[model samples]
Target: MFVESVVRWGAWSILLQFGLGVSAGFCPPRCACRPDTMEVNCSGKHLTSVPESLPSDMKRLDLSQNKLKTLGRRQFLGLTQLQEMDLSDNVISMIEVEAFQGLQNLRILCIKNNRLKIIPVGVFSGLFSLQFLDLSENEILVFLDYTFRDMGNLQLLEAGENDLVFISQRAFTGLQNLQELNLDRSNLTSIPTEALSQLQSLTRLRLLRLTISSLPNNVFRRLHRLRSLLISHWPSLDTLASNSLIGLNLTSLVISRSNLSAVPYSALRHLVYLRYLDLSYNPITSIQGNLLGDLLRLQELHLVGGNLLRIEPGAFRGLTYFRVLNVSSNQLTTLEEGAFHSVGNLQVLRLDGNPLACDCRLLWVVRRRFRLNFDGRQPTCLSPDMVREREFQGFSEKELPRVFICRPSRIIDRRRQEANIEEGTNILFSCKADGDPAPTITWISSQKTLLSPTGRIRVLSDGTLEVRYAQVQDSGMYQCTAGNAAGNDTLSVSLQVKGFPRNRTMPFFTEQGWIESSFPPTANSSAQVANPYPFDAKTLIIATTMGFLSFLSSVAICFVFMFFWSQSKGQIKHTATIDFVPRASMGGGGEGGDTGRFTMKLI
Candidate 1:
C-alpha cells in the first residue's frame, strides 16, 4: 500500500507541471492551450478568417490581407482581452451587430480597404474602450446615428475614401475623446459647423479633395485646438478672408492647386506660430510688400508654379529666420536690387525655372550665389542690346567691355516722332539724345520766348521732360534744343490752334472784306487794287470785247450768205437750168458753162 501511494503522488506532481507550461506558451505545436502573452501573430498561414478558439488573453491580433467576409455574432466572443486588431486589405463585407460583444478591451481597430457598405447600429456595442478606428477606403454608403455611441473612448477616426455622402450629426456624439480625424478624398460639399463643433478634443483634421467652395469665416472657431491642416485640389477657392482662420492654433498649413491670384497678407496674420506654408500651383502674380512681415517664425515657404512676375523690393523684409525658400517654376523677370535684403539667414534658395535677366546689375548677384546655374550655362540677359545675346558663363563684370558709347545727338521733332495723338491736344516737346555730358532740352516758343520756368518744365535724370499741361495760349512754334559737352542741335515744331470755323451763316471770304464787285484795277484805273481772284476789271473787259466780236463775226457770216442767196434767186435758177441741160447735150457745152459760172463768181 505504501509503494502504490508513492507512485500516485509522483503522477499528480507531473500533471501540475505540464499545466503551468502550456499556460505560459511552452505548449507543443498540436496543443489547444491558451498563452499568457497578449501578442498573437498568425501571419503567412493563408488563413481565410480569424482563427477560432484564440487565447482570451491576446491583446493584439493581425489578420491582414485575408479573405474574411463577415464577422457574425460570437466571432470575437473569445477575445475578451484583445486591445488592437488589424484587418486591412481584407474581404470584410458585413459586420453583425454585437459582433465585438466580448471585446470590451479593444482600443485600436483598422479595417481599411474592405467591402463594408453599412455600419449597423451597435456594431461596436461592446467595444467601450475603443480609441482609434480606421475604416478608410471602404464602400460604406450608410452609417446609422450613434453607430459609435458605445465607443466612448474613441480618440482617432479615419473614414476617408468611402462612398459616404451623409453623416448624421450625432454619429460621433459618444466619441468625445476623439482628437485626430481624417475625412480626406470624400464627397463632402459642406460640413455642418455644429457637427464638428462637438469634437472638443479634435486637434488635427485633414479634408483633402473635398470640393468645398468656401468656408465660413467662423467655421474653425470652435476648433480651438486644431494645429495641422491640409487642403488640396479645391480649384474654386480663390480668396481667403483675413478672419477665415480665426481662433485656431494652426501650426502647419498646405493649400495647393487652388488657382489663387494673390496672397492676402491678412489671412496669415493670426497664424503666429506657423512653420510650414505651401502656396504651389496657384496663379499668384505678386507678393505684397508686407506679406511675410508678421510671420516671424516661418521656416519653410514654397511658391512653386505660382506665376509670380515680380517680387517687390521689401517683399520679405521681416522674415529673418526663413530656412528654406522655394521660388521655382515662376515667371519672374526681374528681381529688384534689394529684393531679399532682410532674409539674412536664408539657407536654401531655389531659383530654377525662373527666366533671370543677367544684366550688369544681376550678374554679380548670380555669380556669388551657390546654385544659381540650374543648367551648365548661366542665365541669359533679356535687356540692353549690347549684352542681350550674351550668357552669364562667358561674361564677367571686369570682362564686360567699355562703357556704352554715347551716340551723337540727333534732334527729333516731338510731334512727328509720336505716332498717334489727339487732334486738339498740345504735346510736350522732348527728344532723347545720347551725348558725352548728357543732353539739356530748351523750349523756344514761336514768339522767340524762352520757356525757363524751373517748376513748369523739369527734366528727369534720364532726360524725360514732364511739361505741365499745355493750353491754346501755349500753342506756337516750340523747339527742343538739346546740348551737351558736344555740339547742340535744335528740333523746331509749329503748333497751330485748332478750332471751329469763324462764321457758320455766311461765306468765310465775306467776313474777310471780300466782295463780288471788288476787282483788281488795270493800269488805266485810278483806284488801287489789293488782290485779284477769278476776275479782275481789265481781264473782264478784255474777255467781254473778245466774246462780242466773236458773236458779231458769226452773225455777219450768216447774214451775208442769206442776203446774197435772196438777191440772185432768178439768176441762180437760170444758171442752174443752163448747167443741167448743156451738160447732158454735149461735153464742150458743159465745160464752157462751168467756166463761165466760175468766172462770174470770181468777178
Candidate 2:
C-alpha cells in the first residue's frame, strides 16, 4: 500500500510541472496574455522592440504606443500564424528588409502613426495574403519602384497623412485587387495617371487637401473601374479641363471647396453613370442649359456655398431621376421658368439662405409646393413692396400679380447706339431689359419687317444679335424691341462697316434716317466724292419724312388720351364760386360789408 501511494504522488507531481512550463511559455513578460485565444496585448508597455519570446501560435499581437525605434530582421520569427498585428503609434523609424519575413499568414498589418522614414524594398514581399495594410501618419517620402509588387491581394491601402513627395509608376504595380486607396494630405501636386492605370480594380480613391491648380487632361485615365472619388479641399484648384475625368466610371464624385467659377460641363458630361455629385463650396456664378443635362442617373446634387446667381431654363434638362438638390447659402435673386421642369423625380429641394426675389416668375414654386425644405429659415420676397418681407410660402398666387407690376427702363427708347466694325468681321449687338415677365427681344429691319436668323444673322439665346461676316449691306440701324405683358421697349443700334469703301457706290436711304448700301464701287471710280455738302438731297428728304412721322405720332398720342378721358367713369357735373371781402369791427360800423358768394364742385 505504501509503494502504490508513493507512485500516485510522483505521477501527480510530474503533471503539475509540465502544466506550469506550458503556462510560462505562453505568457510574455510585461504584457497581458490570453492563453486560450493566443492574443497578446503589449500596447503602451514602452518596449524597445517586438518581444522575441512571443508565443509561436499567437494570432493577434498588439505592440502599439511603444518606444521601438527600429525593427530588425527576424523580429516576428516563428510567428507564422500571426493573422492580425498592430504596431501603431510607435516610434519605429526604420524597418529591416526581412523584419516581417516570418509573418506569412498575416492578413492585417497596421503601422500607422510611426516615424518610418524608409521601407526597404522587398520588406513586405512575403505578405501575399495581407488584405489590409495601413501605413498612414508616417514620414514616408518616396515610394520606390516595386515597393508593393508582391502585395497583389491587398484590398485596402491607407497611406494618407504622410510626407510622400514622389511615387514611382511601379510602386503599386501588383496591387490588382486593391479596392480603396486613401492619399489624403500627401505632398503631391499631380497624380501620375500612368501609374494609376495599374489600379484597374480600384473602387474608391481619395485625394484631399492638395495644392493642384488645374486638373490636367485625362487625370483619371484608365480608371474605368473606379466607383467613388473625392478630390476636395484644394483651394488652389481653379480650372478643370474638359477631359480631366475622361475615363472614370465613378458613381460618386465630390469636388468641394475648390475655386471653380463655373460648372465644368464638358468634364461632368462624361460622368454619365454618376449617382451623387457634390460641388459645394465653389464660387460658381451661373448654371446654363445642358450643363447638368446628361446626368440622368444622378440622384443628388449639392450646390451649396456656391453663391450662384442664376439658373437658366433647361439647366436641369435630363435629370429625370434626381431626388435631392441643395442650392442653399447662395446669392440667387430669382429663378426662370422651366428651370426644374425636367426634374420629375425630385423629392427634396433646399433653397435657404438666398435673397430670393419672389416675383410672379417664382409663383409656380408656391403653387406647386414642391417639397421646399428651408430648415426653418424661409426665403423672403424682394419685390412687390406689399409682400417684400413675406416668406415664400406665406402668400397665395392671387395676391402676387397685383404688386408685381414691372416698369420698362426709359433708356430703352433711345436712338441708335453706334458700333463700328471692320468689313468681313463679326459683330454682336446685345439688348437687355428688366420686367416682371422677363421680356422677349426681337430684331426688326429698316423695311418694316422682322429679321429672322439667316446665314449671317444669328440671334443668340440671350438676346444677342450676331452678324457674321459683316458686309456693306449689313451696315444699318437694327431695331431691337423687347416686349412683355407690362410694356414694350425699343432700342436702335447702328453698325458702321469700315475698311470696305468698295460698298459705298450705291447707298439706299430709308425713312428712319439710316442708309443701306448694296453696290460696290468700281476700280476706275474717283476716290473722293465731288459733292460739297457730303450729304445728299435724298438724306435730307428721309430726315424730313422721319420728322413728319414723329409729328403724326404726337398727334395720335394726344387723340388717344382725349378719347380715353371722354370715356372716363369720373366727371365734374356742377360748379359754384364764392368771394368774400374783409369785415369791419363789431363795435365800429365800417363803411359797408362786402357781399360774398361761394362756389363748390360735385361729381
Candidate 3:
C-alpha cells in the first residue's frame, strides 16, 4: 500500500506540469494568441501598460491603438525572441532607460504617432539586431549624443514630421549601416554633415521644406553613395554657390517651388549621370546655353509653370537623350532658329499658353523636317491680325495672300483673288488688317456703287462684307479700303455666282461663314448647277463606276486563281498516289517488282 500511494502522487505531479505548459498558450482576456505562430495581439485595448502575462516566446507583439502612456523598465524583459513590436498610435510619452532591455533579437520597433518628446540616450540599448526604427510623428526636438550609437545594424531611420531643430555632433556616431534617412518638415536649419558623411551606406536623403537659405559649395560631396537628393519648398532659397553639387554620384535631383530666379547652372555641372530633373514652379525667366549645357544622360526635364520668356539658340546643347521638355505657360513671342537643335531625341514638347508671332520666322515649325510632337494644346497665333487665333498645327503658307505683306494698314483675306458661290446662296468676305493704331474700312463695287449696311448687305464689326442673296448683278469686283494714320491700302476680290436668283432679298454674308438670301429658287432654264465638293456630278459618277469595275476585277481574279488551285491540287494528289504505290508494292513483294517497274514505265 505504501508503494501504490507514492506512485499515484508522482503521476499527479507530472499531469499538473503538462497542464500548465499547455495553458501557457491560452488566449488571455480581450487578447489573442496563436500557438502555431507564437504571436500575441493585444491591440485596441484600454490597457494603460503592457500586459505582463504575455507569452515569453512570442515572435510578434501588436500593442497598437492602446492607451499605454509610458513604458517602464523591464516592460519587455522576457520577450527576447520578439522580432517585431508595434506600439504605434499610443500615448507613450515616456520610455524608461531600460525599456527595451532584453529585446536583443527585435528587428522592427515602431513607436510612431506617440507623445514621446525626447529620446534618452541608451533608450535602445540592447536592440542589437534592430534594422528599422520609426519614431516619426513624435515631439522629438533635439537629438542628444549617443542617442542611436547602440543601433549599429539599423538600416532605415524615419524621423520625419517631428520638431527636431538641432542634432548633436555625435548623435549618429555608430550608425554605420544606415542606408536611408528622412528629415522632411522638421524645420532643421542645419544638418551635421560631418556625422552624416561617416555613414558610408547612406544612399537616399530627403530634406523637404527645410529652413536653410543657401547651400555652400560641395555641401554633399562627402555622401559618396547618395543616389537621390531632394531639396524642395525652401521659400527663401535664392542662391546656389558654385560647385554646390560637385563630386557626387546622384541619379535624381529635385528642387522645385522655390524662389530661384534662375537655375544654378554652374553648380549643376557636376551631375554627370543625372536622369531625372524637376525645377518646375520657379521664377526662372530665360533659358540660355550656359543654363543646361552638357548633361548628356538627362532623360526628363520639367520646367512647367514659370516666368520663362525666351530660349536662346543652343539652349539644349548637349542633352542628346532628352525625352520630355515642358516649358508651358509663359510670355514667349518668338524662338531663335535651331533652339532645339541638339535635342533630336525629344519625345514630348510643351510650349502652350505663349503669345507667338506668326510669320515667315515660324517656317521651321511648319516644315515636316522638324516633326515636333506637341504635348498639350497647340500654340495659336497672337499677332498679325490675319492669322490671329489660328492654331499653328493647321496654319499654312497657302492661307497667306499672294501679295500679302504686314504693312501699317493692309487688309489680309484668303479670297483676295476670287470667290465662287450659288446665285441664291450667301457669302462672307473678311478684311482683317494690322496697323499701329485703329483702322477704318470701306467697301466699293465694280459698278461704282458704294456698299454699306443695307437690307441683305451688312458689314461686320471687323469690317467683313456679308452678302445675303447672290444674283448675277451682285457678281462683280469688290474692293476693301483700309485707312489709318500711317497709310492706306486696298484689297480686291471678284465674286462669281452661277444660277438665277431665288428671291431678291439683298444677299449678305454671316459670321458663320455662310450667305443667306430671302429669295425663292428661280429653277428656270437659265439656272446653273452648284457643286459643293471638288468633283462635279459627272466626275463622281465616273469614279463610282471605275471603283465598282475594279472591285469586280479583283473578285474575278481571285476566283480564277482558286479554280486553278483546285485542279492543281487534284493532279498533285493523283501523282503522289501513283508514285507511292509502286514503292510499297516493290518493297513488299520482290516477285511483283516487274509489275511496279512496268507501271512506272507506263507513267
Rank the models by TM-score, top first: 2, 1, 3
Task: Please write out the lDDT profile of model 3 over residues 1-603, one tens digit for every residue.
Answer: 999999999885764433222224444556766655677788898878788677777788899999999998768998778999999999999998978999999999999899988999878999899999999998989889889988999999988888988878788878898989888788677656666766778888887777788888767767888888888888888888887788778888888888889978888878888888888878999888645766778887778778888787778766778777777777776654456645457677666777876654455555532367786468677877767887767755676442123237767654446779876677888788777444678888778677777646667777888877676678888888887544788888889987745544544456675454565556674454555789988999999999999999999999999999888766442222233334554437554444332223223
List ranges where model 2 is wrong by over 4 Å: 1-25, 34-38, 368-434, 437-472, 475-477, 483-603
lDDT of 2 by residue, 21-53 (tens): 223355566777665566788899989977767
Candidate No. with top lDDT:
2
How would the candidate models be sorted by lDDT, starting from the highest? 2, 3, 1
Point out the worst 10-residue segment of candidate 1 by lDDT.
Answer: 500-509
- The local lDDT score (0 to 100) that residue 41 gets in candidate 2 is 85
Candidate lDDT values, in order: 0.67, 0.79, 0.76
Total clashing pairs for each candidate: 0, 7, 14
| Cα lDDT of model 1 by residue, 1-603, tens digit | 999999999885664445333232333222223344545655444567677566666677777776778888867886777898888888889888888888888889999998998999988888888888999999987556788888778888998999877777777778788888888776666765667777778877887777777766777767887888777888877767678788877778888888678876777888888888888888999976766778877887788898898787677777766677677779885554455645446666665567765433353345555544233433455545566655555564465434222334556544453312322343554566655434566766556766664554444454444444333354555567787433687776655543322221111223454222322343444554347578889999999999999999999999999998888865443322222323445434433343222212322
The top-ranked prediction according to TM-score is 2
lDDT of 1 at 55: 60
Cα RMSD, each candidate? 20.4, 27.9, 28.3
lDDT of model 3, residue 264:
80
The C-alpha stretches of model 1 lying farther than 4 A from their native spots are 1-38, 42-49, 142-144, 360-603
Candidate 1 vs. true structure, TM-score = 0.59
Cα-based TM-score, every candidate: 0.59, 0.68, 0.57
